[model samples]
Target: MGVEITSPNFKANAREALDDNSLQKALGLTVEKGFIKKRRLAADALPEFEALRDAARDIKNHTLDHLDLYIEAFEKKVVENGGHVHFAEDAAAARQIALDICRKAGARTVTKGKSMITEEVGLNDFLQENGIVPIETDLGEYIIQLRGEHPSHIIAPAIHVNKAQVEAEFRRVHTALPPDRDLREPESLLAEARGILRDRFLAADVGVTGANFCVAETGTTIIVTNEGNGDLTQTLPRVHVVFASIEKIVPTLEDASQILRVLARSATGQDMSVYTTFSTGPKRPEDPDGPEEFHVILLDNGRSALLGTPFQEMLRCIRCGACMNHCPVYQAIGGHAYGWVYPGPIGSVLTPAVIGIEQSMHLPSASTFCGRCEGVCPMRIPLPKLMRLWRDKAHDEKVVPTAQRFGLGLWVLLARRPKLYHLAMSVGMPLLAAFAGSRGRFRSLPFAGGWTRHRDLPAPQGRTFQQQWRARRFGR
Candidate 1:
C-alpha cells in the first residue's frame, strides 16, 4: 500500500498516539538516550563547529541562489561521466520514472538504503504493485518493513519499536528459521537481519538509495551511514538509482565537506558516520565491483516553489533530525503523530509546503515555540520562525478554524487597549487564583480541556505583574 497522508487529522492522530502505551514506552527511551548531550560534547570538542554551521548555511544559500546554473552543471557532469539524470516534477512523476527504470532493467528485486525521499514518493509499494520486491537494507528500516509501517523517526525508522517488538516481528516473519533460535538480545537480532539482507543484496538487480548531498561540481552523490548497508545496497546490484530532492545539491565537494563536519555531530553525536560513500557515475570498464548503470531521480515535489519565499530557509535543512530530537512536543509524542514522511519541526514546516497549508495547518500550530529546534539545528535554519511564518500564512488564508480565529480576535481587541488589558488581567488573575484554591492548580478546566487533559494548569498568583511592579516601585 502507498504511504498515507494523515496530516489533515494531525491533532486526532497525536491524541491517539498519546494514549498508546507501547508508543509511550518507546518515546521515553528516546528522551533518556537523546542526542543533546552527545551533540554538546561533540560541538564543544570542535571550537570551529559554530563557524562550520555558518559556512554550511551560507553554502546552501549560495547554491540555492544559483540552483539553476548548478543543476545544469550537475547534469552535464553526470552525462559526461556516463550517468543519466531524470527530473521529476512531483511524486507521481518520480514513481513512474523509477518504475520505468526497474522495468527496463527487468529487475525482480531491489535493495534500498534508508531513503526518506523514496518513502515520500511511496516507491516500495509502487514497486511491489508492479511485481518487484523492494528490500530495505537499513536495520531500522528492515524492521519497519516487516511490520508494514512507515518510519516514525527520520534516522531511526523503527524508534517506536523495542527489542521485544523486534523479536516478535522476526519470529513472525522469519518462520524458516528454527523456532527455538536464541533472539533474546539486540546482537542476535542484528545478526539475523544481516544474514537475511546479505542474500537480498547479492540477489537484487537494482539498488535505490537517498543522497545526503549531490555535488554540482562533479555530479557526485553522497550518502553517510553508520552501517555499511548503503555501500552494499548500491554496489551489489547492476543498476544503482539515487533518489534525491532538488535542494540536496551543493555547489562543490568542499561545500559538502563543510556541511559534513556538522552533520554527524548534530545527528548521532559522532565525529563522523562510519561510512561515507561518493559515487560519480556508473562503474568504469576497469572497476572491480560497482553498478553498471547509474541514474538519479531529482524530485521537486513543491520544493522549487519554496525558493524566494519566506519558507526558502527551510531548504537549508540537512535532515540531521536534531530539531525533532530536541523538540519537547516531538519528544513526548514521537514522529508518527505528525502523520507524514517528514515529521517533527522540519516536517511541520516542509509538509505544508509540499502538501499545502490548508491540509496541514495543524502541523505548524503543533509547535510550543520553545525554539529548541532552531537552537540545535546544525544549519541554523531558524525553524521556529519558519513555523510561525506558516501560521501567519494559514491565518491570512483564513484556513484556521473559527474558534481559534475568534479567540485570537478577542485577544487582539483586548491587547490593543492597555487599560482594558490591565483591567481584564487584574480581574482574571484574582478569579483564577480563587478557583484554584490552596492546591494552586487545576486538574481540569472548562474551555481548555486540551491543556488540562494530560497535565494540571498552574494557578495565577491573584496579582497581575503590573500590580506587583507598582507595589514594589511605590509601596502602594
Candidate 2:
C-alpha cells in the first residue's frame, strides 16, 4: 500500500534478498516444486475438479449479480442479531471505523487473524499510530510482522521465506529467547512463537479477522483456516471486528458451503480445513466465552464500482491463492513484485483498479497468458482475459509508453498485410544477423534497449519459418 511494486523493479528487492545464493535457491525450489506437488495432489484427490470449478464459477456469478440484494439482506440480519454493520467507501474510512471502535471500547492490544482487507486498509498501522497494538495471530503473518515484511503469498504469506530465515527472525523478535538461541526445527520456532502470541491473544482487548464468506440469509461471517487461529482471534477478545469486501456476501450458507468445497481442495489439497467457523453475531448472554462486541466493516474501496463491469468476475474470488500459487509470473517474481497489497493474476488485475490503472500499467502485462491461473481458480475467474482488459485500459489511458504504442502500431500494420510483412521480414533478418554477429545474441538494439540491457536476446535466423515452410512444400 505504501510502496509501488511493478514486475520490472521488484527484481531489485528480490536480488537484494537473494544476495546469498541460498535464499534465491530456496525461493526457486519452493516456487517451482511446491506448486507442482500441490497441483498434482489436488488433481489426484478430485476426479471431477473441472466440473466442481464450473459449478463454483456459476454460483459466484449468480452471487455477483445479486450482490446488492444480498448485502442489504446481510446488513438487516446482522443488525437483527445485535452485530453492528458499518459501510466504508474506502480504506481510510474503514481504518477510521476500526480505530473508533477500539478507542470507544478502550482497547490496548488487538489480535488479528489474517485478513487481506485489513491489510488493504492498513488497519495495523492505523491502530499502532493511535497507541493500540495489533498483533498478527496467523503463524505466517506473525513471522512477517516480526520481520517488517509484507505477505508474499495470499494463503502462504511467508512462502518465499525459509525455516532458517524464520529462525533468525524469531531470535531477533522474540523477547523471551536468549541471544545464544539457535533453533532450526520448525516445531521449536512455532513453539516459541506460540508462547509469545498466546500471551498477546489472552491479553488483547479486541480481535479481528477477514471473512471468507458472509451469508446474507443468516448474517454469518464464515472463516476457513487450518490452524484454528481465526477461531481464537474471533472468540478470545472482548470485541471482535470482521473486515471484508462487500463482494464476499453470498445468499446462504449453502452457497458458502459450495465455495468452501473448492477453497480448501484448491488451496492445500484438503477436503476441508481443520476449522470452518461461522460466527453469527456477538456472544449470547448465556455463552461462557466469545466476543461481547461484534463489528463488521464492509469496505467498498472500488469493489462496488467494478460490480457491473467486466472485472466484476473478480468478486467471485475466494482468495484461495490458487491463482497466484499456479502463476508463473508470481512464482518467478514473488508477490512483492506486483507492488501492491494484492499480487499474482488476481493482483495484476485488481491492484490497477484499486490504485490507478496508470501506476500499475506493467502489472497486467507481466503475465505470459499461460491461463494456468484461470484453469486452477476454484471460481474459474478469467484472470488472463481480465488482465488483458486492464492492459487495454492502461493503453487507452496512455499509461503505456510511446515506444510500446509505436511497436504495437507497427505490429498491427505488418499483420494486416501478409505480402509486405514477409518482404519486410526478409530484408530485416540479415541486418539483424549482422548486428548479432557470430554470437547470435543482441546486447543492444534500436527501440529494444530495455530488454537487451539485462539479458542477451537471441538473434532471429535470416530465414523466416514461413518462407522455409513454403519452399519445402513446393520443393523449390
Candidate 3:
C-alpha cells in the first residue's frame, strides 16, 4: 500500500503498460469491447439519457455552489438519525478518524465495500499497521487486495487483471481450497471469492463504505452496487463507517434519484444496479438487523480549494468512469500509467488539482483531446478543457520539460512569421517525401522515435496543407 506519487514517472509507467501483453488483452476485451459497447447500447435504448445527463450536471452544480450549507444540513440530518459525523481536513485526518472509530469499537477486523476515498487515503495498510484487518468485500477490490496493488480502474478495479491472473491469485491466496478447483470460468471464480469472503464478512467487527450520494434532506447515504456485498459489509458489523468526500452531497432524495438514472448506465450499462442500498442510521429496536453505531467521515482533501476555481467542474464527478472507458489514451495504456487513486480523463484533470500540477504535469498532456471523455461524461464536466487548463498552468510555471518548452517556443516563433513558416513547410515537405522511396511511412524519424518505434509515421504527401487548400479553393 505504498501508493507513492508515480505520476512523475508516467512516461516510464506507460511504456511498461504498453509492453504488457496481458494488460493489453484486458484493456481490449474489457474496455474497448466491453464497457464502451454496452454503454452505447444502453444510452441508445434510453431516449432521455442526454436530458438526464444535463439534469445530473445541474444537480451537482447547484450542490457545489451551496456546498457548505448542504454539508451542514446533511450533518444535521445524520445527527437527527442517530449517526455521528466527523469532518477531516485532509487524507491523514480522515485515516486517523477512521482508526479512532475502529479502536473505540474494539474492531479487530473490518469489512469494506468499494470505497475510492479509502483508497485515496491508503486506509487498508494503515488499518493493518494499527492492528486492524480491513477486508475488501467488492469483488474487484478484493482481487487487487490479494495482489497487493492499487485499483487500475475506478469502478472496475481489477479490469487490468485477466481471468487467468485471477485464477492464479485465487490459487495462490486461497491455499485452503482444493488445488484442482475449477476457476477457469468467471462464475466459478466469483463463487470461490464469495465463499472465501463470506467467512470474513461474518467475522468482521466493523464495516466501512463509500457514499454514492449523501441525501441532505433525509440524512441518508446511498450506495449502488451490482454485487450485494455492500449490504452485508454494513449490516453484519457492529459499527458502520460511511466515508465520502464533500462533493457527494445532494440537496434531496429527488436529486439523487435523477443522478441515479444515469450512474449505472454510464458505469456498467445497466438500467439500474442490482442493489441500490440506502442507510439512514444505526439500527432501531424494531429493526431486524443493522449496525449498532453509525459514523460519517467527510474528507475535504483539497476539494474545498477547488470550489471557485476552473477545476470546480471536476467536483461534479460521480466516479461513474464513463469518461475513462471512452478515453482513447486510457484504452491504450490502461489506468496504472496514470499512477493514482483516480485514473484516465477525470484523473488527468483531478489528480493535478488534488496533488499539485508540478507533481503531475505529465497527466494533462496524456490526452489526445479527442473529446470523447467530455462527450461521454455523465456530469458533463468539461474534461478536455480542464486538462488544457492544467497544461497551460504547467507551461506558465515552467514545469514542462525543457525540450517541449523549446519546441513550443520555436512553434510560436514560426507561427508569428507566416512567410517563413510557409517557406519552411514547402521546402521541408517534398524533401521528406523524396527520402521515402516507396513506402509512404517512416520506420523511424528524427525527434519522433516515440511514434515510429511503436508504429510507422505517415510521410508527408509533398505538399503543405495551405498549398493544397489553395489548389482546391482556387483551382490552381
Candidate 4:
C-alpha cells in the first residue's frame, strides 16, 4: 500500500536488469516487434492520422485550460445520472476513498481491469491489507500480480515476462491443475489464465477500472481495451468504481472520439481497440446486466499544481505509450529499469513532476535525447523538452550527484572562456585521436567508464569542430 520510491536508484536497478538474462531475452524478442510495426502500418493506412493527432492535442490543451469548468460539469452530470464523484487530493486520499467505497459495498473480493492509476495509488495491496482480495483480470496484470511485481510496461504489463516464467508461476500457483498440463505455448498459457480468472469474475463483489477518457458532457467514463476483461470487471460486480486522474476529462464525447482515434493506433497499432466501453452511471432499472452502483474517484495527486506550469503540456498525454515504445533506452533496458509506475520518456518527464524531482532526478537523465519518443508521440508531447526541464530543475535545486555537478561545473567554467575552451579542445582532441591510432575508439576512459565499459567511445577524428569551422570560415 505504501508508495515505494526507487527512482533514485535507477542506475543500480538498470545495471541489475541489464545482467538479468531472462528479462533481457524477453525484452529482446518483444520490444522491437509488435507495437512499432503495427503503429506505423496503422498510421500509414489512415490518411488523416496526422490531422487527428493535431486535433487530439488541441482538444486536450483546451480542456485542460478549462479543467475547472469541465470538472464541475462532469460532477453535475454524474450526479444527474445517479452516480457519485469523489475528489482526492493525493494518493493516500485516493486509496482511502476507494477503500471506503468497497467497505460500504461489503466487498470481500474485487475484480480489477488493467489500471495504471490503481498501481500508482498502490490500491491492490491496500485493499488486500484491509481484508479484501483484489484480482487482476487482465492477462498481463494477472501474471505480474502473481509474481508480486508492478507492471513493466504501460500497455503490456507482463511484456518483460516470457512464457517459461509464466508457466512456472501458473504451475506454482494453480496447484489444483493437472501437473502434466501443457503450458509451453502462449495460447495454452492464455487459455489456462482465462479458465482461472473466470471463477474470480463471478465471485467478485466489487469491480474497479481506470478510465481512459472521461466525457464531461455525457458523464461517461470511457475505457478502451483489446481484451473484454474490462467489461466483465466493471459489470459483473455489485458495485463499480472508476479511477481517473484530473487530466482525463475532455469537454465532450466528440473530443473523446478525437483522442480515441489515436490511442489504439499509437499503442497497439490497431485501428480500434476491441472493446470501447462507456459507462455513464450504474445499471438502470431496465438494464439487463451491469453494476447497481457507480462511483468515480478523481485523483489530483499533484496534477492540479502542474496546470499553469511549464510542464502543463504533459497533461495532453493520452497514455498511448508510443513514446516508450520507440525509445531506444526503454527498448534496451525495458520498463522496470525506470523504477516507477510509468516508464520511458513519458515516465522520465512525468515521474519527477508527480513524485518530485529530488526523488526521480535519474529518470530524466536516463534519456539519450534521441527524440524518437517525441517523434512517435500521438499527442505531439515534446517529451525530450520536458525531460530537459526536469534536468534543469534538478540542477537548479542542486539535487544532482556531486560528481555530475562537478563535471558540469568544470565544463561550464571552461566554456565561458572561449580561449581556454579552444585550448583544451585543441590539445585534448588530437591526443585522444592519436591515442586511438588504428582503432579510432576508446575501449575505456578514466572518468567515463560508465560509457566506455559497455561500448567503445568513438574517438575524435582530428581537430575539434571549432578548429575546423575557423579554418573553413577565416582560412586560418
Candidate 5:
C-alpha cells in the first residue's frame, strides 16, 4: 500500500500512515478482504491443489535446467518470424538496447503493459527523461503513474490508492474534469481513464509489454492479463518491444499452459485471466493489424549465475504472487518495504540475486522464518530455504557489520563444544536473570542493542532445549 511506499524517513512515514484512519482503513480492507476471497476461490476450484502445485514446480525446474537450449531455440524462431531478438546481460545494457530501438523507430509516445523488468531498469523515467512520453496502459499502473508513484503491488499496482484517492488524482491530472462528472465511482473513473487513453493508444508509435512466457517453438511472446491491454499494446502500434527475463522462455505453448494453470488461481483466484494474448511477430502483408517491427529483449540480469545453485528453484516462479498473498511481513508492511519492483518473498530473494546480496543483506532477515509463503507458493519455491542460503552467502561476503560478525563468531565458539556451551550458559544466565528484574525480560540487551531498542528478549531459564530433550530421552 501507499503506506509502505515512503521514500525517506520510512519509519516516520509509516508511523504517520498508521495513525491516519483513512489510510489504515484502505490498507486493512485491501489485505483482509482480498486475501480471504482469493484463498476461498482457490480452495473451492481445485481439489488436488497441493498436487497441482508440485506438478507446476517440477515443470518449472525442468525448464530452468534446460534454459540455454530453450533460449537458443526461441531466438531462432523469433528470427525466422521477422522479429529481432537482443540479449542483455544487465540493466544498463537492457536500457541501452530498448532506448536505441525506440530511437530508431522514432517513437514519441509509447503505451506499455505492466512490466517489472521496465521498473527494474527504470525504463519509464529513462524514456521520459529523453523526451519521450510513456503511458501505462494497465489501469492500475496508469493510476499510479498519474500520481507519480511506483507500483506498490505487482498484481495490483494501485491497490494502495483507494477510490477517494483515485478521484483526487483524476481531478488534479485531468484538467477541466468536472466534479459533476461522476468522479466518485470506480466505474466512472475507469470510463474517464479509458476515454482519455484511447487517443493515446491510436497515436502512440510504439507499444511495450513484458512477456509472461515466450514459446521457443513458434517465437511467440505470450502475455496474460485480466484486461485486453496486452493485445492492444502488441497490435495497435507500428513497433512492439517485448522486455522479458531470459528465464521466461519455455519449450512450448504446452509448457506455458501448465504454468497458466497455477498462475491465475494463485494470484487472483480466477481459473484463468480474462486475456491470454500470444503474438508471433510483425504484421504480414495479408494481416490487417499488428506491429510492423517486433523486437524481443531477453534480459539475463544475473539470472544465469543462479543456475546450478540452490536458488535456481526461484526462476520457476510464474509471478502468480500467491507468496505475497500469504507472507506475514508483506501483509504487514506491504511490497514497498522491500524497496524494489518485485516484492514479498520472491523479491527478497531475486533483488539480492540481481543486485549483490551485500547491498540487500537486510532483506532475507526481514522475514520471521514463517513458512506460509513457501506453503502457499504455487511453484513450491522453498522461499525460506533460499532466503537462508542468501543469508549465508551475504555473511560469507562479509556483508554484515563487523560488530555483528564478532558477536556471531563468539556464538559459534560457544556452540561448538558441549562443556563450553553449558559453562557459558551457567555464567550468562544469572547475569541475564539479574537484569530481567521486574519485567522478567531484558529491555536493554548489551550485544543486541538495536534489537532490544524495539523489543524485549526473554532471559534463558537454565539450559538449552537440546539438553532438555537429551535428558528426557536418554537420562543424560
Candidate 6:
C-alpha cells in the first residue's frame, strides 16, 4: 500500500489542474453547475431539509461521543449474525487482514464496489502486487481503473474525464470488442462496460465494498448507490468484505435513517438513491444468493487519536460530497489537486489530521475561506473553522514557507499598531488610485501580480474608511 504523495507540491498540482483544458471543461459542466443546481432544487423542494441536516449532525455527534460503545455493540451483533469483524489500527494492518482473508478463500479475482476506504489504503495495487486481480464494478470506477488514475471526485470518480476520453480508454482496454463499434454516446459506452463486467462478476471469488453506515442496534452494513453494481459485486462472490473507517457507525437504524434523508439530497440531489442495500451476515442456509463469508474490516488509521481534539468534529462527515460540490476552490481545481482520498474543504481538514500537518500544510492554504462548503454540508461540519485550525497549526509549527511566515509576521506587526496601520493605508490608497488612472482598475500592480495576471484588480473604490470617518467626524 505505497501511495504516492504530492500534497507537498499542492501549488504545482493546482496549477496543473487549472491549466488542463479537458479537466476544466469537465469540471465546468459537471461540477461547477450540475451538482450545485440540483442540490439547490432538491433542498428547496423539501421543507424539512434544514431540520434534517441539524438532526444528522446531532446523531453523528452523539455516536462519536459513544463511539467505542457503538463499535463494540456492532461487533457483538455481527458475531451473533455469523459475520466476522476485524479491527485494524492502521492502513498496513487493514491491508494485511484483507490479504489474509483473500488468501484463505483461495481467491484469484475480486470484484469491487466503489469504496474510498480501499483507495485510502491502496488495496487494489497491493492486491495486484500479490497476484490477485481486483476489478472495479462501478461505472465511474471502471473508467478510472482502466485509465490507471485515482478518483478525481468522491461519488463521481470519473468526473474529471469527458466522454471522448472515456471512449478512447474503452477502445484501448476493451480490445476484445469490435474496433468499428460505435461508442460515441454515453449509453453505448455503458452498455459495452456492462457487457464486459458481467463476466467478471460471475467469476469473482471475493467482493469488496464500503459501508455508508454500520448500525450498532442490528449489526448491519449499509451502502447507498444509484447503480445496482454493488448488489452484484457482493452477492455473486464467495467472500464479501467491507472496508470502512471506525467513524462510519450509528447507534440505531433510526439514526442511520436520519442521516440518509439528507445524504442523497446533498450528494446527488435525489430524494433517495436507487439502491440502499443492507447486509447483516453471511449467506444463511435458506438464502438463494448471498456471500458464503461475510467480513467487516474497521480501520482506525489515526481517526481514534482525533476523538477528543478540535478536529474530532470532522468525523461527523458522511461523505455526501456536498462540501466539495459547493466549494469554489474544489470547483476550480478539482479533487486531485488536494491529492488525497477525501478532497475539498473536508479534505483540507481531514488530510492534515490523518496524514500529519507537515506533509499536507499546503492543503489548508488552498482555500479562499468561503463559507459555501459549510453552508451545503448535510452534517453541518464547521469546515472553514477546522481549516483555520490547521492553518494556525501549520503557522505555529513553521510548516509553512518562510515567505508566507514573513508576510504574516509583517501583517501582524502592522495590525498591532492602529495609528501606523491607518497612516499607511491613508497614504497607500491615494497613490494606488492615482496610478490606476481613469480605468478604476489596475491591470498590473507591484506585489499583486498573482491577482492582476488573471484579472484586473479593482482600484481602491474610495478613500480609506478611517479617512472618511475622520472627515465626517471632525470636518478635516
CA lDDT, every model vs. true structure: 0.92, 0.85, 0.94, 0.92, 0.82, 0.92
Q: What is the lDDT of residue 418 in candidate 4?
A: 96
User: What residue pairs are clashing in model 5?
Assistant: none
TM-score of each: 0.94, 0.92, 0.95, 0.95, 0.89, 0.96
| Weakest lDDT window of 10 consecutive positions for candidate 3 | 1-10
Best by lDDT: 3
Candidate 4, clashing residue pairs?
none
lDDT of 4 at 203: 96
lDDT for residue 315 in candidate 6, whole number 0-100: 99
Please report, as a residue range, the 10-residue window in candidate 1 with the lowest summed lDDT: 27-36
Those runs of model 6 whose alpha carbons end farther than 4 Å from true positions after fitting are 433-441, 460-476
Per-residue lDDT tens digits of candidate 3, residues 42-78? 9999999999999999999999999999999999999
Candidate 6 local Cα displacement, residue 42, angstroms: 1.6
Backbone Cα, N, C clashes tallied per candidate: 0, 1, 0, 0, 0, 0
Segments of candidate 5 deviating more than 4 angstroms: 1-27, 427-476
RMSD of 1: 2.2
Which stretches of model 4 miss by more than 4 angstroms?
Answer: 428-441, 457-476
User: TM-score: which candidate is best?
Assistant: 6
Candidate 2, poorest ten consecutive residues by summed lDDT: 1-10
For model 2, name the residue pairs that clash.
5-339
Off by over 4 Å in 2: 1-23, 179-182, 430-476
Cα displacement (angstroms), candidate 3, residue 345, comes to 0.3
